[model samples]
Each structure stands twice: as structure tokens, then as C-alpha cells.
Target: MTTAEEIIAHLRSLRNQRNIDGMRRFGIAPTGEQLGIAAPVLRAIAREHRRDHELALALWSSGIHEARGLATLVEDPRQVTRGQAERWVRDCDNWAATDALAFLLDRTPFAEEKAHAWSTRKAEFVKRAAFSIMAGMAVHRKELPDSVFLGFLPVIARESTDERNFVRKAVNWALRQIGKRNARLLGAAIAQGVKIQRLDSRAARWIAADALRELRSRR
Candidate 1:
């Protein structure tokens, strides 16, 4: 039972001011006691305490940005719950943390449910998590039938109008990933992309054009 404090203490030792400054230039704003640790280092730490659910929870409660990212890595998907997912997502203040949470949450049993629930969320990071999870699932969840992703096409189309940079990028990621999954979904995602292209919003057209470019080239 490695304690969260001990791990966070270790994280503090690995902090890099250069890394922190570099991350900020890419829109990864500092949030809550960030230690300026690189992601690969955190991932290595998580591997050390893999599947430590209690430790993950405690780290998350600490409200340290990198600790929260490490929490996502160390958590057991089997132990994750809807309540925890909601709580952690609401804590996400940056795109990096949001993507870390999405990467882990996408492996949970209730990922699809949370994806839909969070997609319509008012919070920018929360909404980004929804599609980030969707994008991850498309790449990794092979056992899930195509119908699951097919159902997601409409949601992707609907959300394409979001003008926020993070949300639109994630929406495009989800669409492109789904189209790459299989021939059937490729056709479906492409059609959805074309429909999205017709939407009045600038964000929608950008999302559609980017997704359609890759998806069409693949066809």
C-alpha cells in the first residue's frame, strides 16, 4: 500500500521548470499545485503502482494536477464508478488532464454511458472528455460492435457546432477515429462528416473538413 503522499513527494523531486513553461505554450495551463513533471515520468510512476485504486483516489483528492493525471493511470478500471468519474471530470481544468481522464475512463465498463452524459455538459473539459473517450474507444474497444459507434455518429454531428477550440478538436478526433475503425463505420462517419459540413457553424465545417479529409483519403 504505497501512500499517495509518498508518491506525490516523489513526483515533486522530478519536477522541471522548463517542462512547465513548455507545456503552458501548448495551452496546458497550470492548475492546482502542479509539479511540472513530464507525462512519461508520471506514466512510469503509475506503472509502479498500477491498479492501486485506493492510492488513485487519494491522489485525486490531493487536487494536484499531475497527481490527478497519475490517478487516472493507476486506477483500476474495474474499481472505477460513475460517481468517481463525474467527480474527477469536474476537476479537470486543462486539456492534458482531461485527456488523461478520458484515456482511463474509456476502458471502464460504463464508458459509453459517461461519454453520452458528458458530451452535453456545459463545462469545456468535461465535454472534451466525452469525445476524447469516444476517440479512444474507437481505437481500442474492438469487442464493441459497430452499432455502438454508429449510434455515436449522430451525437458527433450534433456536437460539431461547438466553437470552443478543445471541444471542436475532440469532436474531430472522435469522428476521424471512428471512420478509421472499419469499412462500414468509415462510410457512416464520412456521411456524418458531409452532413456536418452543411451546418452553419464555422466549427462544424472545420470538424467536417478535417475528418472528411482523413476519412476520405483512407477510403
Candidate 2:
């Protein structure tokens, strides 16, 4: 068994100060220990270890940015509980960590429920997680019906006025991903974007314009 300490040490060995600086430049200011390791490298390391629910929990508890990311990759979706998802989401301080965690959570059965619940949160990152999870589901969960995503459009429109950079970007991402899912969804998303365009807020207009452009281009 690869111990969490051993994994942490290995991650340290792979750290690059330049990458850490680069990450900071990109706004990935991890709240805990940030090794500055690139995501692809961490993903390759995760592929080696595969699923280890316990190890994933330990890694996440370590508060190392890359370790938490690795935890998401190695976590067994079946073992992921709603409580664990909620706990980890509250710890998210950056887009990279939040998006990675959301992607992992999207694989769990609790995804849809959490997506709607978290989007209503006032915290910047928590609300972003909601839309991030929706984007992940749109990309990965092929079995989900169009209605599942369509139901999210109203939430997207309602939250489109959120002027936070992370929140609005995520809202746009979810809208675009959902629209790209299929022809039916594409039409629905475009219509929703048009409605969002009618809103007075700058954020809503931006979200609507961007989503409509992409959704229309895909048609």
C-alpha cells in the first residue's frame, strides 16, 4: 500500500517552483500546501494508483493542492458520500481544486442534487462548484436525459446575474456544455441564453452572449 506520506513526499519531489508561480499567475492560489505540480503529471501518478477510497480521503485531508487533485482522480465514486462531497466542496478555495472536485463528484449519484443545492450558495466557490458539477455531468453522463439538464437552465438564468468572475464563467461553461450535448439541448440552451440576454445585468448579458455564440456555432 502506498502510504499518504510516501505519496506526499513523491509529490514534493516533483514540485517545480516555476510551475507554482505560473499557477499563481493563473489564479490557482491553493489554500494549503501547493506543490506547483502540473495537472497532467498528477493525473499520470493517479493512473498508477487507481481507486483507493481511503487513500483518497487521506490525501484530501493533507491539504496539499496536488494531493487533493490526486485524491479526486483516485477516489472510488461508489464510495463517495454526500457528506464527503459537501465537506470537500467547502474546502475549495481555487477554481482548479473546485473544478477537479466537482468533476469527481459528478460521477457520484449525489451529483444532480448537489448541483442544484450548491448553485444557490452565497459563497463564490460553492456556487461555482454547482455549475462546475453541472458542466461535468453534461460532458460525462450520457445516460442523463435532456430534461435533467433543461431543468438546470432556469437555475443558470437565475444565477447569471452573479458578477463574480468564477461564478459567471462557470455558469457560461455549464450552459455551453449542456447546449453541446445534442441538437435538442442545443436549441433549448440557445433559447435560454436569449432569455438571459434580456436581463439587465452585465453578467447575464455576457453569459448569454458567450453561450449563444458557442451554441449557435455548434448548430
Candidate 3:
């Protein structure tokens, strides 16, 4: 069994001050220890571990930023319980980590339920996690009906008023990804964007414009 401590020790060896600085410059700061490992390298490490759910849980409990990301990569989504998801999501300190968790979370059975649940949160990263899961689902969950995503549009619009950079960007990402799924969704998303544009918020207008730009280009 590959131990979490062993992986963390190896991750310690891979630290680069330059990479850490670069990540901080781009607002990727985590609330805890972060080894300056690039994401590609972490993904490679995850490939080595594969779907070791126990190892993933151990890695996540370590509280190191990159280890949490690696945990998301190597964990078995089938093994993800609602309690585990809730616990891990509270640990997200930055957009990058939030998105990493969201990608893994969207693969789980309770993804849509969580997406709707988290969007109502007041915490910035937590709220952003909702749309992050939604965006991930748009790309990966093809079996889902268009109406599933359609239900998310109102939530996206509601969140568009959040001026937080991370939250609004994720709102735009979800809208854009859902729109790109197919022509039917594209039309609905475009209409939702127009409605979002009508809102009295700078964030809403920006989200509308950015999504509309790319969505229209797809037409």
C-alpha cells in the first residue's frame, strides 16, 4: 500500500519556490502547506496511485493543498459519500483547489444535488464549487437530459450577481459549457445570458457578455 505520508514526503522533495511564487501570482494560494508542484506532475502522480479510495481519503486529510488535488484525481468517485463530499468541500481555499474537487465531485452520483446545494452558500469558494460541478457535468455527463442543465440556469443567473471574481467566472464557465453541449442548450443558455444581462449588477453583465461571446461564436 502506498502511504499518504510517503507521497507527501515525495511531494516535499518536488517543491520549487519559483512554482509557488507563480501560483501565488495567479491567486492560487491555499490556506495550508503547498508544495510548488505543477498540476501535470500531480496528475502523473495520481496515475501511479490510480483509484485507491483509502489512499485518497488519507491524502485529503493531510491538509496540504496539492495532496487534496491528488486525492481528487486518485479517489474512486463511486466511493464518495455525501458526508465525505461536504467535509472535503469545506477545505477548498482557492479557486484552483475548488475546481479540482469539483471535477472529481461531478463524477459522483450526488453531483447535481450538491451543485444545487452549494450554490446557495455564502462562502465564496463554496458557492463557486456549485457552478464548477455544473460546468464539469456539462462536458462529461452526456446521458443527462438538457432539462437537467436547464434547471441550473436560474441558479446561475442568481449567482451572477455575486461580484466575487472566482464566483462570477465559474458562473460564466457553467453557462458557457452548458450552452456548448448542443443547439438546444445553446439557445436556452443564450436566452439565460440575455436575462442575466438585464440584472442590475456589474458581475451579471460581465458574465452575460463573456458567455454570449463564446456561445454566439459557436452558432
Q: Residue 89 in candidate 3 has what lDDT?
A: 90
**Candidate 3 lDDT over residue span 1-219, tens digit each:** 778999999999999989999999999999899888999999999999988999999999999989999999999999999999999999899999999999999999999999999999999999999999999999999899998899999999988999999999999999999999999999999999999999999999999999999999999
How well does candidate 3 score on lDDT at residue 139?
Answer: 98
Pairs that collide, model 1: none
Tell me the spans in candidate 3 whose CA falls farther than 4 Å from its real position.
none
Reference-based lDDT, residue 188, model 3:
98
Report the C-alpha lDDT of model 2 over 52-117, residue by residue, as the tens digit.
999999999999999999999999999999999989999999999999999999999989999999
CA RMSD, predictions in order: 0.9, 0.7, 0.7
Per-model lDDT: 0.92, 0.94, 0.95
Count of steric clashes across candidates, in order = 0, 0, 0
Q: What's the distance in Å from true for residue 64, model 2?
A: 0.6
TM-score for each candidate, following the candidate numbering: 0.97, 0.99, 0.98
**Which prediction has more favorable TM-score, 1 or 2?**
2
What is the per-residue lDDT of model 1 for residues 1-219, given as tens digits with 9 covering 90 to 100? 678889888888888888888888999984688778888888888788899899999999999889999999989999998999998899899999999999999899999999998999999999999999999999889999999899889999999999999999999999999999999999999999999999999999999999999999997
Weakest 10 consecutive residues of candidate 1 by summed lDDT: 30-39
Query: Which window of ten consecutive residues has the lowest lDDT sum in model 3?
Result: 1-10
Off by over 4 Å in 1: none
Report the error of model 2 at residue 206, Å.
0.6
